[model samples]
Target chain A: MNVFVVGVGLIGGSFALDLKELNSNVIIHGIDINESHLQEAMELGVIDQKSSYENLSLADVVVISIPVNAANEVVPRVLDAVHEDAVVIDTGSTKAPLCELLVNHPKRRNFLAAHPIAGTEFSGPSAAHVGLYAGKTNIICEVEKTAFKLQERALKIFSDIGMRIRYMDPKSHDRHIAYVSHLSHISSFMLGKTVIEKERNERDIFDMAGSGFESTVRLAKSSPAMWTPIFQQNKENVLETLDEYISNLLLFKSYLEKDDFQAIFSAMESTNKIKEILNGIVVKPI
Target chain B: MNVFVVGVGLIGGSFALDLKELNSNVIIHGIDINESHLQEAMELGVIDQKSSYENLSLADVVVISIPVNAANEVVPRVLDAVHEDAVVIDTGSTKAPLCELLVNHPKRRNFLAAHPIAGTEFSGPSAAHVGLYAGKTNIICEVEKTAFKLQERALKIFSDIGMRIRYMDPKSHDRHIAYVSHLSHISSFMLGKTVIEKERNERDIFDMAGSGFESTVRLAKSSPAMWTPIFQQNKENVLETLDEYISNLLLFKSYLEKDDFQAIFSAMESTNKIKEILNGIVVKPI
Candidate 1:
C-alpha cells in the first residue's frame, strides 16, 4: 500500500506513523511545502520517502492534512492527479467550503472531507506521534459524496487506528464545530493575549498561575498558520459563536458590577452540567 | 501535633491528608458547617477526628479552606480562638480583603494569609488526595505580619508537602490573580455556557467537542459556592480583567468582520509567546 501524506505536520505525520505501524506492506510518502518538515518526519521514521503531487499517481491512499485555506486549493489538485481507485481524504478543521468546492469535480467520489477531533496545542512533524487518533471522534462530512469502496477503505484505516466515526452534513458540521472547536480556540488565544499584555506589569503572575490556568490557555499555543485560515473559512458561524460568548461574558461582568452574587452563582451552577457532557470525551490519563 | 482544618472540602481535606502523611504524631480534626462533609472526611481518613472551634485552642495548626467571604468572617475568629503558638492560615483565592480584616486583630501575628494555587475542578472531601500541593506554588501574602515562630511552623509544613512559596503583598496578589486566575475562570465558564446554550438547538454539539474544549472548559466545573465569593471579594480587579478580555475578543471579532486574516494571524503569533511563559511552569505529564 502506497500511503501519500501531503503537508506532513502534526496531523499528517501522526497518521503516517500509525498507518505504517498497522501494516508492514505500507510505504509512507511525505509531501510538504516546508521541506524541513519532510526531512524531520523522515528522520523520525514517520515516512519512508519524500514525494510530491507529481508522484501522487502511485498512491493507493492520499491524506491531505494542511491549513484549511491551503487544503481548499491543494485538495482539488491532488484529486485531479490521483487514480479513481485511490481514496483521497483531506483532514482540515472546516468542511462546508471545501465540500462545496469539490461538489462539481468529476473525481468528487475519490475525496473524503474529514475533521479528526484530536490534537495538542503543538504543531509540526516533531510534535507528531502514534496513537494520536486513538479513541478520538472523527466527523465525516458529506460522506455520501465519496465512492462506496473508497469510504470502506478509509473506514478500514480509521478503524485500525482506533478512531470512532460519525456522519454529518457539511453545513451542520461547520456550524456545530464553530461552537465546540473554533470558539474555544478564539477564547484561549484572547486569554493568552490578555494575560501576556498584563505580564508587562506583573512579572510574577505566571508563578501564581496553576495547572488550571495552563489547561485553560493550552490552545493559545496552536499554530497560527493552521488556525487563522480555519477562523476565516468558517467566519459566519465563528462570528455567531463569538457574539454569544462575548454577550455571556458581559452579562457575568454586569452581575459582578451590581454585586449580584446569586445571579453569578446561578450562571456557574447551570454551566456545571458541562461536567457530565465532558465526561463523554475519553480523557487520557496522566 | 494537633491540626484542625475548618471547612473540610477539597483544599482542607487534601491538606489534612498531606499533613497526616508528614508525621505519625499528627492528628487531623475536621470542622465544617455541613455535618455530612465532616462525616465523609472522617470516613475517607482525610481527617482522623471531627472537632470544632471549642477545641481549636489545642491546635498547633489551623488551615481555613473555605470561600473568601466566609474566610473574612471566620479567619479572625479562628485567630482569636487559637493559642499564641498555633499558626492560623486561611487558603482563599483572594488575599487583600482577608489580610485587611485581620491586620488589627489582637492575634494578627498568629494568622497567615496564604493562598494555595492548587485544586481540581471537583470539590468536597472525596476530591481530596495526598500530594495535591506537591510542586505547586503557595502565595504567602503579608508574611511579615505573621509571627516569626508561627511562620516557621507553617513553612515547615509547606516544605514537607513539597510546595514552593512566594511572598507578595495581599493587594498585589489580588490584582495579579484577577488576570491570571479569576479572568480564566470567567472565560471558561462563559465558553461552557455559550456551547451549552447552543446545545439546546444542536444536541450533539458535544460529540464534536474534543480534549481542547475539555481543557478550556475544565474550570467551568468548579464549585459556584467557592468561586462566587472570590469574584465578590476581588470585584474591582476581576472587572478590570473582564474589560480587557472583552476588548481583546471584540477586536479579534472586528478583524474577522473585515476579513483581516493577517491581523488575526499576527495576533495569535504574538500570543504564541505564551508557549514559553507556560513552559516555565512545570507541566505534569499526561
Candidate 2:
C-alpha cells in the first residue's frame, strides 16, 4: 500500500512509522515543504521515499499533518489530487475551520478530519515514534460526511494501530477540544510565563521547583509554529476557554486572600475527581 | 540511632524508609494522631515502632512531616520534648511561620527548618517508597540557628541518602516556594476545577484530554489536607504569586482577544526557556 505522509513531522511521521511497523507492505512517501524535514524523515526511516503533491495520485492513504492553518488551506487541494477510493486524513487540532472550508469541495467524501489526542511536547520527525497513538482517543469529526467505505478503511487502520475513535460533529469537536486540549496548552504556557517573569528577580527560584512545576509546565515546550495556527483558527473557542480558566483562577486567588481554607480545600477536594476521570484515560509520561 | 517520625505519611514515611535503608542502625518510631497510619506505617516497614510524644526524649533525630498549620503548632512542643542533642527537623512546605514559632524556644539550637523539595501527589504510608529523595533538591532554612554538631549529623544522613541541600533564609524559602511550588498546586487545582465544572454540561469532555491535560492537571490530585495548611501558613506569599499568575493569564487572554498571535507566540517562545530551567531538575513521575 502506498502511504503519503505530508509535513513529515511528529504526527505524520509517527503515523507512518506505526503503519509501516504494522503492515510490511506499506511504503511511506514523505512530502514536506521543508526539504530538511523530508531528508530527516527518510533518514529516520519514517518514510521510504521523499515525494510531493505531484505524486499524491499514487497514494492509497494520504496523511496531512501540518499546522492547522496550513491544513485548512491545503486539504482541499489534497482531496482534489487523490483518487475517489483514496482517503485523505488531516490530523489537525481544530476541526471546524477545515470542515467548513471543505464543505463545498468536490472530494469532501475522501477527506477525513481527525484530531488524534496524543503527543509529547517535542516536535518533528526525530520526535516521532511508534505507538504514539496507542490507547489514545482519536476524535473523528463529521465521519458521516465521508464515504462509508473510506471511513471503514480509515477506522480499521486506526483501530489496528491501537487508537480508539470517537465520532462527533466538527462544532462540538472544536468547542470540546478548546477545553481539554487547547486550554491545557494555554494554561501551561502562561504558567511558564509567570514563572519566567519571576525568574528575573529570583535567580534560584527554578532550583526550588519540583516535579509538580515540571508536570504543569511541560506543554509550554510545545512547538509554537504548529500551535500558533491552532490558536488562530480556533480563536473564538480558545478565547472562551481562557476566560473561564482565568475566572476560575481568580476565584482561587480570592479564596486565598480571604483566608478561607475551608473553601480552598473543598475546591481542591472536588477537583480530585479528576483522578478518577484521569484513570479512564491512560497517561503516558511527559 | 533512634528516629521519631511524627505524622508519618508521604514525606515522613519516605524519610524514615530512606533513613532506615541508608543507615541500618537507625530505628524509626512512628507517631500520629491517626493510629491507623501508625499501624499501616509499621506494616509497610516504614517504622520499627509505634510511639508517641512521650518517647521523643529517646530520639537521636525527630522528623516533623505533618501539615504546615500543624507543624507551626506542634514543632515548638516537639522541640521542647526532644533533648538538646536530638535534632528536630520539620519538613513542612512553608518554612517562615514554623521558624518564627520556634525562634525563642530554648531548644531552637536543636531545630532545623527544612523543606525537602521532593514529593509525589499521592499521600499516606502506602505512597512511601525508598529513594524518594535521590537526585532531588532539599531546601534548608535557618541552618545557622541549629548547632553545628546537630546540623552535621542531620545533613550527613540526608547526603548519605542522596539528597543535595541548598540553604536559604526562611523568608526567601517561603517566597520562592510560593512561586514555584504553591502556585503550581493552585494552578493545577483550578484548571481541574474549570474542566470539571464544564464536565457538568459536557459528559465526554475528558475523552478529548490527552497527555497534556493529564500532565497539567496531575497536581490537582494532591492531598488537600496537606496543601490547605501550607496555603494558610504562607497566605501572603501564595497570594502574591497567585496575583502575578492570574495577571499573566489575563494578559494571554487579552492577546487572544485582540488577535495578536505574534505576542502570544513570543510569550510562549520566551517561556519556552522553562524547558531549559526544568532540565536542571530531574522530574520524577507525577
Candidate 3:
C-alpha cells in the first residue's frame, strides 16, 4: 500500500511507522506545512519520502492528520486531488464540521471522518511511536456515507494497528469526544495555570508533585495549535461540560468550607467508581 | 530498634516494611483500630505482630499514621503513654492543628509533626511496600519542638526509609500543601464526578479513556475516609485554593464560549510551563 499522510506529527507519524512495520512493501509519503516537522519525520524514518499534494493521485490511501480547523479546510482539497480509487480519511478531534463540509463533496464516499482515540501529552514526529494506537478506540463517524470498499479498507488498517472500532454519527461523536477528550484538556490546562500562578517556585512543584498531580496536569503539555481549534469546533459541548464541571467544583468547595465531611466523603466515594471503569481499559504504565 | 506503629494502614504499614527492611534487628509492632488491617499487616509481613498502646513504653519510636482527624486526636494520647525516651511522630496531611494539639503536652518535645510526601491511591495493609518512601520527601513541621535526641532518632529512621528531609512551620506546611497536594485530590475527584455524571455509560468511558484521562482522574480512587478529614482540617486553605482553581476554569470556559481562539491558545500555552516543573519528578512505575 502506498499511503500519503499529511501533517506528519504524532498521529500521522505513528501511523506512518506502523504502516512501514506491518508491511515491507508499504510506502509512506509524508506532507506537512511545517518544514522542520517534515524533516524530522523523514530523519526519524516516519515516511519513505516527502510528497506533493498533487501526488495524492497516485496514493492508495490519504490520511489528513492536521488540526481540526485545518482538517475541515484541507481534507476537501485533498479529496479533490486524490484519485477516485483513493480512500481519504481524516484523524481530527472534532468531526461534525469536517463531516458537514465533506458531506456534499463529489468524492464524499471516499472520505471517512475518523478519530483515533490515542495520543500522549507529547506531540510532533519526535513524540511518535509504533504502538501509539494499540488498545485504543478508533471512532468512525457517519460510516454509512463512506464507500463500502473504503470503509472496509479503513477498518482493516485500524484493526491491523490494534484499535477497536466504534461507529457513531458526526453529532454524537463530537458531543461524546468533547466530554471525554476536550474537557479533559481544558481541565488540565486550567489546573496547570492555577498551580503555576499560585506557586511560582517550579522547584517546589517539582518536588511535591506525585502521580496524581502528573496525571491531572499531563494534558497541559498538549500543543496549543492542535487544541485551540478543537475547542472552537466543539464549543457548545465543551461549554456545557465546563459548566457542569465548575458546578461540581463549587459544590465540593461549599462542602469543604462547611466542614461537611459526610458530603465530601459520599461525593468522592461515588466518583471512586472510576477505579472500576479505569481498570477495564489499558492505561499507560504510571 | 523497636518501632510501635498505630493505625497500620497505607502509610504506617509501608513505614513498618521499610523499617524492617533497613535493619535485620528492627522489629515493627502494629496497632490498628481495624482488626482486619492488623491481621493483614502481620500476614503481609508489614509488621511483626499486633500490639497495644502500652507497647509505646517499650518502643524507641512511636509512629502515628492514622487518618488526619484521628492523628490529631491520638498523637497527643500516644505522647502521654510513650516512654520518656520514645520519639512520638504523627504523619498527617494538615500540621497546624496537630501542632496546636501537641504544643502544651508534657512530652511536647518528643512529638514531631511530619508528613511524608508519598502515598498511592491504594489503602490498607496490603497496599504497603518496602520501598514506598524511597526518594520521597518527609516534611517535618514544628520540628523545633522535638528534643534534639528524639529528633536524631527520628531522622535516622526516615533516612533508613530513604526519605529526604525538609523542615517547615506547621502553618506554612499546611498552606503550601493545600495548593500542591489537597487541590489535586479535589480536582481529580471532581473531574471524575463531572465525567461520570455527564457520560452515563461506564463502558464507553472505559473504552474511550486514554492515559491522560486516567492520570487526571487517578486520585478519585483515593480513600474518602482518609481525604475527608484532611479537607476538614485544612478547610480554609483548601477552600481558598479551590476558589482560585474554579475561577481559572471559568475564565477558560469564557474564552471557549466566545470562540476566542487566540486567547484559548495563549491561555493553555502559558500553563504549559508545568512541563518544566513536572519533568523532574520520578513517577513510580505501576
Chain A alone, TM-score per model = 0.98, 0.96, 0.97
lDDT of 2 by residue, B50-123 (tens): 99889999999999998888887788889889887999999989888888878888989999889888877999
By lDDT, rank the candidates, best first: 1, 2, 3
Q: Candidate 2 or 3, higher DockQ?
A: 2
Shift in Å, residue A142, candidate 2: 1.1
lDDT of 2 by residue, A1-286 (tens): 9999988888999999999999999999999989999999989999999988998889889999999888877898888888879999999999999999989999999989999988779999999998888888889998889999999889999989888789989998998888888888988988888888887776567878999999999999998888888999999988888889889888888888888889999999999989989997765432
Calculate candidate 3's fnat.
0.78
C-alpha lDDT of residue A8 in model 3: 92
DockQ scores of all models, one per candidate: 0.85, 0.83, 0.75
| Candidate 3 docking quality: incorrect, acceptable, medium or high | medium
**DockQ of the two-chain complex in candidate 2:** 0.83
Candidate 1's displacement at residue A183, Å, is: 0.4
DockQ, cand. 1 = 0.85
> Per-residue lDDT for B197-229 in model 3, tens only?
987754564566677788788889999999999
Residue A125 lDDT in candidate 3: 90
lDDT of 1 at B172: 90
Candidate 3 Cα errors over 4 Å, as ranges: A201-206, A283-286, B201-205, B283-286
Question: Interface RMSDs of all predictions?
Answer: 0.9, 1.1, 1.4
